[model samples]
Target: MSQEFESIWDAIEPTVGDALVMKVRFKIMSAIIRECRLWKVSRNIASKRLNIGVLRYDQLLACDIASFNIDELVVLSLKAGLDVRLEVQGA
Candidate 1:
């Protein structure tokens, strides 16, 4: 039951060459997950938390990597109860 991005990351990791860079890519992916949660919740509840124009919000969350920023990603993972870690590829 893995996600599309998770499967994509599994295949992409080995080709990244550098473990550090690969970890960064994972971090970005984690952020994308968070953004998805925010988008979903807002949509479901019709949240007033979002003040931006609908078009802008739509454009922002529409990207595949919408939540690729570290700060937002950390928040998303925390909210989702995901214990994120920085690990070496082979470790």
Candidate 2:
């Protein structure tokens, strides 16, 4: 028999809460990456704009999710000129 998951995080995370956190982090990271692409800026300039070091920005570009927490991603998103919003849905 096989089991199916709605998301990759759901299958990988140990619990629902952990999966939710990863999902949120991925979304924020995605938005930041998108903004970076749209800005068409070099890594050094982009990192400066986002107020992060070049290496940290490289980690983000590489989608190194384990290196970042929700709060840090949120702050970085803001510095990238993204308008962050939260919506809570009942499960």
lDDT of 1 by residue, 1-91 (tens): 7555445545656664444454564665546445556555664232234333445445435643443455654544555556667655673
Q: What TM-score number comes out for model 2?
A: 0.95
lDDT of 2 by residue, 34-69 (tens): 999898989999999988899999999999999999
For every model shown, the clashing-pair count is: 0, 0
lDDT of 2 at 54: 98
The 0-to-1 C-alpha lDDT of every candidate, in the order given, reads 0.50, 0.95
lDDT of 1 at 52: 35
